[model samples]
Target: MTQQKVALVTGGNRGIGKEIVKKLIEKDNAVIFTYRSNAKEAEDLIAEFESTGIRIKALKLDVSKIEEFESFSESINLILNEWQVTGIDSLVNNAGIGFFVPFEEATAAQFDEMLNVHFKGPFFLTQKLLSSINDNASIVNISSTATRVALPGFSVYAAMKSAMETISLYQSKELGARKIRSNSILPGPVATDFSGGAVRDIEDINSRIAQQHALGRVGLPKDIASAVAFLCSEDSAWIDGQAIEVSGGYM
Candidate 1:
């Protein structure tokens, strides 16, 4: 019998992360996802899948708090053992905060927060979970289109994502011996509650973003989630160390 696949996703309670979890589950992957502090939302996500006869689990994790990673790794090991899985087949580094501080006004604290959540957090968390990640596993980092397009009020945020993109390449290079593939997905402006929901709720901002895409519409969470699911599957096995833009032909 083919072994069931397992995935560990961060920030899987809402927005793009939530949609990624659902997509993976739809692909028959057993997901063990994390949410920072929303116990209620986490519970709802678990229950929603449970009612559909899909068993999934959620844990509380603050990616900004690197100190908690060791314990979190232990918790993940316990879950893997309970599920009778040797290791997770995929690790989706999807947890992130929306920081839009401009270059002139960005503060030290904001910069550090962005670094902690985007760069430091995923870097170390992947290191911590390395032993539990199966050989040939895929690591998908959720990046932003800000890395490509120059946008005001997004200097720090985009910088952090650029760092993430760099690390993803290094991860693919170093982990190649174990056949672990690492890649980044740069999603264009999506109508989500991220960034205070300006893209989703504000018609002017939404319409402006829509014009940048060839599809003539701002991306939805499922648009990015579908790409994530593809990367995690064996269908993308030959693809590695690449940063894919899932922005509906955003130029």
Candidate 2:
């Protein structure tokens, strides 16, 4: 029998991250996810999934602090040892934050927060965990369609995502020798808490997105999760160094 794969997904306590964890677990992977806070939600999810006999563990982690990555890597090493697994089969950088401040009002702190979470955190975390990533493994970075849509009031967020996409390409090239593939998924306006309910709960805003998208609706967490699962699985073995947009043809 084929061994069950192991995966680590950052910020998997809620939203799209939670859905991605569900999908990965459905694929029979031993999922180790991280959450910054909300220990209750994490604990509840772990308990709920463990009942099904699927291996799921949630660790506390703040992606913004690059200094914490080494410790996180060590914890992952311990998990792998306990599971008798050599290395993790997949890593998903899905933790992120968003704001809708106009460019003129966007503060340095806001920009830095987005940069730290979306770009710097992923870079350092991936570097620290390089050794624990298995040969022929997949790394999926969560980007945004805001980078492509030229959306106002999202310049800083989009720019950081764009940087991540570039980093994904370089990661793929460098890790190719080890047979590890890196790619980015650019999701459009999804009906999630990304904008603090401005889009998810606001009917008019959601309608605007639906009108713009060719699929005639804003994306759902499941949509992005499925795309992420595809990228992590062996089905995408030949795909690497590319940003697959899950925008539903949103221009």
Candidate 3:
């Protein structure tokens, strides 16, 4: 029998991260997911999949907390030992925060938060986990459509995501010697609990965002999750160093 592919996903307890975990698991992959603070939700997610006969593990991780990555790497090593696997086959950098503040009002604190979580977090986490990832493994960085188009108040958030996109390119180039593939996925307005759930719960915000997409609707978590799954799988073997916009043709 073919061995199950294992993936490490950050912020997997909720939002897009949660859905990505679900999608990967449904595709018969073993996943080690991370949750920052909501231990209850993480526990609930593990319990929710208990009947499936697969052991799903959730680790506590704050992506912005670079200091914890060393110990976190040790924890991952323990899991790898338990699984009897050499290393993880995929790593998804999906944890993030968002705010729609204009450039003039964007605080240094907010920019630092964005930089830490969206760029520095993923950059160093991937570096620390490099040995834990098997050759030919996949790295999927979650980016934003704001980097593609100018939004009213997404200057700082988009800039960080754009930086992440640049990091993805460099990762792919540098890791190519190991046959590892790195790519970014830019998702348009998804109706998730992100940014105070304005896109999900507020009628006007949701409608306006949906109207901008060629598909006439905002994205769902599953829509982006499916793309992520594809990228993680061997099906996308030839796709590398690319930023795929999974925005339903958002203009």
> Each prediction's Cα lDDT score?
0.94, 0.92, 0.94
TM-score of 2: 0.97
* Residue lDDT tens for model 3, 1-251: 66789999999999999999999999889999999899999999999888878857999999999999999999999998998888999999999888789899989998999999999999999999999999999999999899999988999999999999999999999999999999999999998999999999999989998899999999999999999999999999999999999999998
**What's the lDDT of the predicted structure labeled candidate 2?**
0.92
Q: What tens digits encode model 2's per-residue C-alpha lDDT throughout 1-251?
A: 67789999999988999999999999889999999989998998898776688888889999999888888889999999988888999999999888888899999999889889999999899999999999999999999988888888989999999999999999999999999999999999888877787779999999997999998998999999999999999999999999999989997
Candidate 3 RMSD to the correct structure: 0.8
Clash total of candidate 3: 0
List, residue by residue over 1-251, the lDDT tens digit for candidate 1: 78799999999999999999999999999999999988998998898867686759999999999899989999999999988889999999999989577799999999999999999999999999999999999999999999999999999999999999999999999999999999999999988889899999999999998998999999999999999999999999999999889999887
Where model 3 places Cα greater than 4 Å from the true spot, the runs are none
List the pairs of residues colliding in candidate 3: none
Clashes of each: 0, 0, 0
* Candidate 1 displacement at residue 104 in angstroms: 0.9
> Which candidate ranks first by lDDT, i.e. highest?
3
- In candidate 1, clashing pairs total 0
